[model samples]
Target: MNSLKGHPKGLYLIFATSTAERFSYYGMRAIFILFLTQALLFDKELATSIYGSYTGLVYLTPLIGGYIADKYWGIRRSIRWGAVMMGLGQFLLFLSASMLHTPGWAHGLMYGGLTLLILGNGCFKPTVSSLVGQLYTPGDKRIDSAYTIFYMGVNVGAFIAPLACGYFGETGNPDDFKWGFLLAAVVILLTIVIFETQKSKYLLSPDGKQLGVLPDARQQALSAEQAKSASAGEQSSRKWRNLGILAALALVFGTLFYLWLGNDWVSVGIFTACLVFPISILLDSSLTKIERERIFVIYIIAFFVIFFWAAYEQAGASLTLFAAEQTDRVIWGWEMPASWIQSFNPLFVVLLAYIMPAFWAFLNKRNREPSSPAKQAIGLLLLSLGYLFICFGVKDVQAGTKVNLMWLTGLYFIHTMGEIALSPIGLSMVNKLTPLRFASLMMGLWYLSMATANKFAGMLGGLYPEAGKEKILLGFRIETMYDFFMIFVIMSGIAALILFLLSKKLRQMMHGVE
Candidate 1:
């Protein structure tokens, strides 16, 4: 079956699966920091560090998962097993929360749960997203629109999970946290059931074969041919040797950073890998001049994206803490759950996702559309503006005095607009620019930016000022909320300006893909 717009039924099936999975992931995230600080009694800095590590590892594993899916297990198997691991991970979290009175047991359980979630996310995230790209053919104009709708589905899950899970978990009782974790587990199980049952019936390629299955003999032969073509040069062997050396260097740097920096090892490792892997690829003698330039463009845009996401992802850490501690949550004589604020960005995404595609269509029809790199620059600008909004909004408010909830709400709205401008488009850009032979690998590399961003977000979140405490970062004093928010304003604003200046050149380097 096809929609009136001619998108296949498989799109909706994948949408449903992704929506439920996101619900599980985001629901857990909604309460994770609160659970740590309130239930386990961890400090704000420690909890945020752990939160960053967990989130960063979640993106990091996709590199491994995408490879396994492409080479051996296929998408369906990887997703299934991944779902199981995630379900178990959530269950462990529930158990951890349930044992909150036993601090030692709960702490052990919490680490165990986080490890599993990281492993599971590595398997599920990239493969499912790649599956969405598979649903559309090359040069399909609807691809962006399809991703927009798919992104809405993601927000639908994100929008609801916080409200539902937060209500259950944050009712002023430490023990209540288990309810949220349990809810996450149940939704993930539901996702697996829906995906396994319906995939055979509705999920199919454009040629009518079932989707997510392992490659057959003929497909394997073709992949081998493509690989051969990609490596057909005298320097192929040397490039492989260089890649190994880079990998070793990455590992060594990662270990040293871990030993020196405490909990930030994952971020350091991912940043190292992101830097090394691209240089190794650029050194590949088989790549054409065009391919090399395109790859360079990807790397350039990816670097700017790191700044964007580091600012944007504060929602899960510093922003969440801000809502809980500083922002006024009372409305019309009712005190709202702090986690309810988690719904705001997704709610805005749901509202704006519909508008953006149409807005872009209007622009494209008139030949007035900005290129992907240009739009991303706009996104970083909006993110900077969002933080600046908060900076000014809270400038008059004293510490320990709650401000209007609208301040946070307005910020999320602006941030969501920035997200719409950047996130979905980045996915489309990667799929369009990558060569077929390196598609899965390139997608993993794209996610590496996210991994670095998330860890960086955590590091920033760790800087959040505690009550009556002055925090200093990079020789600057963060003596007030205004100062904290101003950090992002300066960082994202500068990055956006630089990206805007480079957009024209990056667009040219894309070789007219758009």
Candidate 2:
């Protein structure tokens, strides 16, 4: 399992820290919906809406984190402080849960806890990613494989969190939601402490300056290999001209493409921001022609992946609640825990993650592997199919008796296959598309794709009726219980078709980067 080639032990250090971090984050998140709506008697739909906003903002604020990490605090300092903040936030959450009966004080602390988690996650998320990049050198192919390994660390935490936290929140003593919160807080605090004590053993002593803090002595010598650099004044002006051109494009979408007004606004905003760096290259940027083209191709693929995340992220806010209050959970003479259902996703991810790499190697040997876009398209199609499974399964279940756990379990398995196809590999594609100069910015934008997708997923979930349920789909009348799942299935299918049409163009732009 160990792939060794002078990879500093720090990679494993990061993997361990991430595992702990995921356990803490997911443990809390997986149970929060159930605790809020079921235990606290908040309306399910309102709790879902709020959850969506909370999760969306959690991701959206990273733009600020990236700016500060790049310009002021540096990655290590920002990351450490973020850990401290998140730890404190988790602890506050525990106190809030304790005071749930205290009315006003409870509400204040609840908001306060959420604010800290968002701010802390924003600071920690981007910098930790940047630190991973710092662990590698230019032209190192191992970066892709290393990230796959890191993502597994994420799944490991995701897989275990539900079981651990659900036990505290839902099982044994039912009023122990506070116990779960306390446990989650303690775990996060432990992660922060563990990470701090071994900083030197993990990351190279961060130079507290900029993105260039390579611990490897060889890296310092090779820093001269930078592809391009410009004065801040020149860079700023070039970005402006780039904005002017995109503004024209935006006007076209706003005025002429009226049928898709909402989409037009979003697509234009995305396309406009995307156009900036390449346009900067065309203007103040200094690079060989090959570099610009490569970056352009990467941008093309990035726009394509946004749809994938929009479909995949529905699992947390919407789907989790759907399973809880709607779906039948009766199995083996017991009602299944709603929070426990979420573990099925990462459970599938963990089981099948190792299979894909082997399958890819086999495909690579035979030249039978699908292209990146094709693989991603397949993922969407399968995810769509998974949703369809749940829709059909529960279309006839009794009002409160519960849907079988096996359906959720099976659907997660299919969705995990889709994730393996798209998500794990998408990161590698991003690094390939990004040129050295705009690397961090491009990565930041890449995450914005996820941020938008998560919010949209939340909104989609809200469309479901958590009360007075019934439904119609594909011109056939069905239970309202199954309608939202059907909609998601249809949406993912449409996304797949669109991506399929554009796959050739995306591949062409990739210029063999995949």
Candidate 3:
């Protein structure tokens, strides 16, 4: 049952599921900060911080979700549960918006909704991504191209989300935001219905085995025993060592949370477990030398990913603010919604996704393709260029004067190109390089990088110049928007240069995987 140009039937199913899920997520995100500021009356700093914390936790929880899928729940069950949770979350947000006049209740409902969304995203994001990897066999050349197509599905949802959600949410009185959240819930329910109906027919491996089915308890125990024997020839001792590590990590995190975050035990516990689980895996005694090298490459790339995402994810926070406050968004005598700018990246993605795989295929045929690391380096360079374009375009603009919309649109185009070069490629890289036994867990670790980046993005967004407010960040006085934009230009440019310089060494560490 080949569909989508000879890809497996399951590929399209995953694509649909991913697309709908992204629609739900990006739709809410498109108006989240604006809703906070305009409807809830939160300041920019507070809204950005909440945005950062919400997104950060959304990525962070995937570590636990992925581990559960790997060990017990399996991908299918995890995804279903995640969809339900996210639907509930969206509904809560809808209720929150409905109660906009009731500040206390609305605030509580909003936080509760955010928490559920974070948890649901953890379960949904990594498992679905791992399943996509499962659709192809090891060493399949088509995997990269398949991820590219899947990523295009992601952008399809992202592109439509703001246009649909933003229109209803932003066009009317501020109180109308509930309709958008309600729409997101409806779309997510539709996604669940589609997947539940079609999965039995289409979601299968190449060998015709059902994908994402959990093993029986007996089989799971056997596999656990095998892993223990492989690790140190002593199951009990290894279990104790792992438990000790977890306990120690919990204690450390608990202390930190008490001291720094006003005793936020939930955050402490979740982050502690996220950090500890990966360390335990990396310390496993059974890894082959080649496996260790490949894993090390993943870690190195994950480090660089933090920088990449820190800048790229500004689209949701700082860039959104810029669109609302600085960019001239009038089109044909009507002022466009600020969230409409959120659509530009995905629009460029839809355009470029078609061109990129063919470009890479051409390079491959001629034996001239750049290594994945090199492509990622180029992506960072492009990201820097995007920010530099904004910096230069806004250099002379005054605080009250709106810059041309082209500046923001052009920046999104360049950033979209950068994203195409890096984001899907990074997903493919993790799937390709991960040991099969740790597939979901490793994917979770990959998202952990995003977790860190998102938190940093929030911090950066907080630095965005408020009207008539000047502040010093990293010793630079950000009196104008240009100064704020230049920080990203400098940061991403240096990161790109460093990555380009180190690409050769990183490629060597891949042990010929690419």
Model 1 stretches with alpha carbons more than 4 Å out: 1-4, 215-236, 251-263, 280-286
Which candidate do you rate higher for TM-score, 2 or 3?
3
- Tens digits of per-residue lDDT, candidate 1, 445-493, equal 7888888888888888888978766789889988788988999999999
Candidate 3 total steric clashes: 0
**Candidate 2, 1-514: lDDT as tens digits:** 2224546556676777777778878888887777677656677666765676667667655656765666566666777787778878877777777776786776678778888988887777766765665666655766766777777888888888888888887773436777777777777776677667776655652233233243222222313433336566866887787778766765664455345425534333433344343344444345456666666655555555666666677677767876776667777678777788888888887788778878887998999877777877888888898888877777866666566677878788888998888776776666666654444445565666666666556556566564464434446654465766777788888888888787787777666666
TM-score of each: 0.94, 0.83, 0.94
Listed per model in order, the count of residue pairs whose N, CA or C atoms clash below 3 Å is 0, 5, 0
Q: Predict model 2's lDDT versus the native.
A: 0.68
Deviating ranges (above 4 Å) for candidate 2: 1-7, 172-175, 204-300, 328-331, 468-479
Q: What is the lDDT of residue 80 in candidate 1?
A: 91
For candidate 1, give the lDDT of residue 283: 64
Instruction: State the lDDT of candidate 3 residue by residue for 175-293, as single tens digits.
Output: 99999999999999988998899988888878888888872221233345446564454766877888897778868867776686565444454445545666777776666788888
Candidate 1: pairs in clash: none
